[model samples]
Target: MERRFEPPVDGRGAQSVSVPTRFGLATREADGDWRDYMEMLEGPPVKLRTSVVEEHPKTILTFNTSPDIGFDRSINAYRGCEHGCIYCFARPSHAYHDLSPGLDFETRLFAKPNAAQLLRATLAKAKYTPRPIAMGTNTDPYQPIESRYRITRSVLEVCLEARHPVTITTKSDRVLADLDLLTELAEHSLVAVAVSVTTFDPKLSGKLEPRAAAPAKRLAALGKLVEAGVPAHCSVAPVIPAITDEFMEEIVERAAALGVGSCGWIPLRLPHEVAPLFREWLSVHFPERGDKVMSIVRSIRGGRDNDPDFFTRMKPSGVWADLFRARFRLACKRAGLEKPNFELDCSQFRRPNVGGQLRLL
Candidate 1:
């Protein structure tokens, strides 16, 4: 292994000071071995800057037959997320492109500018069948960069014009920007949204998911979506043991107070590269409970950092898992929250004309 010294970035979640082993590949230091002592004497390290590259994928829709996931078809507007969440399961994906799943996963981003066009073409196929297309399943569609690219918005426009059913999951207030479109789709029973809330503590939230919407803002967004008649739900995702797990009931109760009738929760999952990244975060932020947290996580994951088996992965078992599930269920029941079961109407789908125009009669 080789080491290179780069200036540390500020306001980011992962304290990825050292690069981890590359996945299935050997890595050599890109820069020369010796550092310039004169440069180190200059000043403190500079922050890591984010960069975006335009990716023109051949196809936009990714199909999965995994029995655990709810949807079979989904779309990712971007390849890398700017939110910099240390526990993001999608971090390992960056390795396929030879990028670091640590800092690089957040700082280096890829935007699919032609995603909406490809989606339209795919939906227009003669054999195509309409189902609720899930967005933000892999990476958040409304991450900070969405404000600039607007690719997610374009996709929603296409879905609306075709009267296609769609489901969205996000942690950003940016979703509110598309209220007009979502409201229209809601009227037709064609849309549902879930806002993920990890913790209400602003400090913990900032450390866990740097640059994403604050917890309060996310709750507010969920309230706004529900007020607009969209089938909005609260997602208490990745409930970390010895950390954010305590907030599960609080999140559910708050969402219920905001008129959100449905809720869901997922135990924290540390697949592949995410495990080390999360460990680094824990050491930096909560050193005292880091080991205890991992102990519980391993117990839930069958003595491993992760459980890759399809069904078992989704259904985390063990004492901690059972306890967490029980608490979440009791909280939801007390709050009068029901598990969301809003089925989007697919009968209204219509293939737009070749010129990307919808013929409304």
Candidate 2:
């Protein structure tokens, strides 16, 4: 195996690991090139700057038939997540573009600037059926770049105009920017937002999801959403065993205190290239217990770095799994929280106008 390349990109989850693309393709590696030399000429190491390449596609909706997934369709406005979560299952997706799922996945990104228009076109079809369109399903729609691109807000506007039902899953407080749209949708029970809180420790969260909103900010976003009458769900996602599991109770308690309607947890999932990258991350950040962390992970993963089977993939087994379930159940009970309800009303959906068409009031 070729050794993974380490890059000096500040504010990244995997500080020194970039697992090469598994797909057989020509990939660029840092070869003490100009960027590396810039470190010597400059005071500190050269940082990897974020770049975006636009893609124009006929359709913006993606359909999946997996039994466990809740929704049938989703929209991914961005290809790679800038959050650079070390354990993101979606990291492998960048390999298809001949990019490393490590640093490349965070710095080199693809944006669908025309996604809102494409989504409008799809919803305007005469035979179009209304179902909850999911955003942030693959790559988060409200990552840092969203403030400038505003693609997510544009999509929300289209949904609001069509009276379409939509669900947003994000890890950024930037979702608060569209509170006006979400507030209106909630009035009709057509929208739900799930904010994923990984950990409450700021330092740990910074290391885990580098560019995502801070834990406090995410919790505050949840509070604001619930206060605005928008259906809010606090997703204690990818609870890292031995690292973040300790905060499960605190997170649930805080969510309940904030008047959050629902809450849930998803165990850590290391899929494909993410496993190696995460192992490297563990070695760097938690050298003392890296072995122990992987041991617990493997125990729950059926003696592997990951579990990829359907049904069982999302539902991890083993004693560790049982312990986690019981702990989360107790946490929710103590916090007066319930399993999140993502179902929203789709009956109010009206076909959006296409091209230059206008609707009569």
Candidate 3:
């Protein structure tokens, strides 16, 4: 295998690794010894790689007309993620660009350096009406790269200037860097934030989401955002059944204690490529529980790896789903939390170009 490295950028090496995509079967020795040296030779290293690309998407604002999600429009400042969460559903999206949804989805990343400028141009159009624009709906806006690029911050600067309503969702404490801006936006009922957290187990967190902030740090971030006057809620999204479900109540209680008024949970959905990638990840890290975990997932998914129907996709079916719903609702009751108040005021929207032509109220 050939390898090359570029000079360090932002303290992280800009080295790239590329591998041809292929498939293989899962097998072990007759003695059930997984670590036997010869077993290693059966599957070759796929040479996972990375490459840095500067992107400029035509439109920074993505209008989603999907009935499944609550928000109608969203923006992603970056593509491909650095956090490396094994169960990330966004993984399959990379395949559209002829990129592997495995390592390439994390290591081979792209950053849109001009997203803020594009957003400003978009909002400046005369016919454009204002509404709450959602961020971090796909790739995180506050990922590690934000510290240096600050693309998300620049987008928020435009939103602030336009008096546009904005909602943010992220797993990084880096959002704290924009506290002053968020505070000002909140005053006009124009801003809210959601923090996605799966579990409080540090060990599982390290292996599952390799580069994300520690669970403790995320909880501390929740507290800090609340204290700083940001309307923050806790989101235990894509909760893997049988793995992190056991901690549902504890997560809710912790968020409530930290002054988070709302909490919600979603069962893990392995749409398309995520199912295989997550299975590979399971075999590598949690071999013993891999089968059981997938079994429960199938139970909730109605004997399939995924259910893509609009309303039912987010809320699964079968006895397992019932049990999860019962447990989640009971936990929310005990923690004194309610379904999050996600509504934002859309009437306060202002288009910079229309102000001079005044109208009689």
Per-residue alpha-carbon lDDT of candidate 1 for residues 111-144, written as tens digits (9 for 90 to 100): 9999999999998899999999999998999998
What's each prediction's clash count? 0, 0, 2
Please give the lDDT score at residue 178 for candidate 2: 93
TM-score of 3: 0.84
Tell me the whole-model lDDT of each prediction, alpha carbons only: 0.85, 0.84, 0.75
Work out the TM-score per prediction. Answer: 0.92, 0.93, 0.84
Ranking by lDDT: 1, 2, 3
- Best model per lDDT: 1
Q: At residue 322, what lDDT does model 1 achieve? A: 92
Q: lDDT by residue for model 2 over 1-361, one digit each (tens)? A: 5675464444566555446557864645543211221233234544565789888988999998999999999999999988888888898888887788877787788889999899989998998899889898889999888888999998888888888899999999999999998999899888999999989887788778877888999999999999999999999998889999999989999999999988999999898888888888887789899898899899998999899998888888899999999999999999888787767888888888887354675
lDDT, candidate 2, equals 0.84
Per-residue lDDT of 143-236 in model 3, one digit per residue for the tens?
8888988999988887877779999988888888999999888887889998888888766775577557767888888899889778899988
Of the candidates numbered 1 and 3, which has the greater lDDT value?
1
- Model 3, 119: alpha-carbon shift in Å? 0.9
